[model samples]
Target: MKLIKLDAIDSTNDFLKALSSQEELDNFTVVTAENQTKGKGQMGAKWESESGKNLIMSILVKDFLYDNEQVFNMSVIVSLAVIETLKSLDIPGLSIKWPNDIMSDNKKIGGILIENTIKSDGRIVSVIGLGLNVNQINFGHLQQASSLKVICNVEFDKDSLSFLIIEKIKEKIEFWETNSALFWKEYFNSLFRRGIPTPFKNLYNQNFMGIIKGVSSVGKIQILLEDDSVSEFDIKQIQMLY
Candidate 1:
């Protein structure tokens, strides 16, 4: 577990990607930054965090999955790892909103963005980006944002928290290839709003009500619609209303 700490960087994922391309990097090589000039998030949304007040990190992983078909499994493993790490810290009401939004008490606390590259020899390399609000107390206009500090009302050591999360992710990856089914089961168990009526907005900009039934192996969320039918939607096609 080689760690690289930067005072500032454009994006940790980009830095790690460039490094991996230049040379053979060790597995679980982590890059975390105190400030990001252009932080990224799922769906092109900006991951806004106060400078030095959040965990902005990206990890390099290789040989976790052989091909692209099992890419969604990366999400399952990483999401479950973060959930379990937070649960151990006594963060209450933690759940994974579909895909990979870390939520506590129905408020957004963290998110994950995974970028994979396939080499000519058919090997896959993944850059797992995780952004978690740690000590920040104010979210100017973001109505749905919260932090561990606000939730627990105590300051947390960001260094210790990040290391614990990294360890948990490694633990999951260690047994994933053979025990994948078990990881999927735990992921669904920690899924947010599972089997509960929820509101959603589709790509067509229409509001509809549905219940989350299950997530496809390819990462599409299965929702039970109003007409008693189950439909699958990708992240771009559906937005779960909090």
Candidate 2:
């Protein structure tokens, strides 16, 4: 694995993409920045933070998945890797929220963003971006946010922590290649509020209560409505009010 540490950058993903276009990209390469001027999140939301106080990195991988449906499973892998890494560091109450948010005591500690590039030969390239709160103790206006320093009551070395996560990801990737089904099963078991009644909103902005009933093979969220009817929803089809 190659590590490129930057004092400051626009976004690690964008930097990696530029390298890919220039044929300078390598598999298992990691790009870490002291700050991201324009970090992005799911649905194009801005990822906000102060420079040099958090973990902002992007990892590149080639041929991550052959089937499109398997793409969502990447979140499972990444989330598990993060949770496991944190636990190994003695970070208690660390768990993965649905779809790839790291939660420490029901508060967000980190997030994952995975994107892909399709090559002409039909191979897929994956760019996995992770933002982990390390040294930051407060988020000012962002509620429900916490960092390792605040949670653990001690400062952390972001560089060492980043390498630990990378090692965990490599191990998880190996596990995924041989036991994908098992991984999915475990993921559903660890899913946030699985099989528990929760309020959710459908795409049409209809709000209702339902129980999360595991995810499908394709990563669609399955919910059992109040009337005992089971329904599945694709990404962006439903939003859970957690």
Candidate 3:
């Protein structure tokens, strides 16, 4: 559980990748950057934030899984881990928007990116990157972003807050590894807009309306259709529209 904190870095994810090849960094080794020069988001989206005003870090976890299918569940692991961390901070209305956005009052407050790499020893390693909006008091032109400072009307000590978050994540990870069913159940309970009809655009660019019924055990999002039946989709297969 050693943490390496950097004043700035090109990207914490990249830093971890570089370290990964240099003799396996132990599981729970964390690298964090106060400012990320080239932050990355899912699907090549850009993750940007005002310098030193957010939480940007990557965790190196070796032996995360045995197969490719289990790789996809990393999203569930990270999202639920973060949700638990935020809840421990007494943050209100915090919920997870599947595949990996953390939301509060329907506004995005954090995100996670889980990358899997195959090691030379035939093991899989997971790099879980998390970017959380913390003490930045204003969203300004970033219409969809929000911060803990904005919500709570007070600033937080960045380093202490980051450590607290990591501690919560570690605790949740253990809980998830032991009680998976209860983990998923708690995760589903924190799902944003669950049971409420929402609009989404599918991969084919077709629009559809469905209610979030919760996620299947296999990790696909279960969407309750208008016909009273249910369907499920992987990430990016369906984009929920705000």
List the global CA lDDT of all models: 0.93, 0.84, 0.82
Instruction: Give TM-scores for every candidate, taking all chains together and pairing residue i with residue i.
Output: 0.98, 0.94, 0.92
In model 1, the runs with Cα more than 4 Å from the true position are none
Task: Please write out the lDDT profile of model 1 over residues 1-242, one tens digit for every residue.
Answer: 99999999989999999999999999999999999888899888888889999999999999887878899999999999899999999999999998999999879999999999998889999999999999999999999999999999999888998899899889989988799999999888889999999999989999999999999999999999999999999999999886
Q: Which model, 1 or 2, shows the larger TM-score? A: 1
lDDT, ranked from best to worst: 1, 2, 3
1-242, model 2: which lDDT tens digit per residue?
88899989988998998898789566789999999999987767788877899999999977567767678877888888888788888887876666777888777889888988877777778899999999887798888889998888988998888888888778878778798888777788777788779999988999999998888877778899988899998767888787
Arrange candidates by TM-score, highest first: which order? 1, 2, 3
Local lDDT at 35 for model 3: 92
Clashes of each: 0, 0, 0
Error of 1 at 160 (Å): 0.9
Best by TM-score: 1
**Candidate 3, residues 54-128: lDDT per residue as tens digits?**
989998877557777677566776787777667777778998888778998878999888778887777888888
lDDT (0-100) at residue 143 of candidate 3?
84
Q: Give, for candidate 3, the lowest lDDT window spanning 10 residues.
A: 168-177
Query: What would the TM-score be for candidate 1 when compared with the true structure?
Result: 0.98
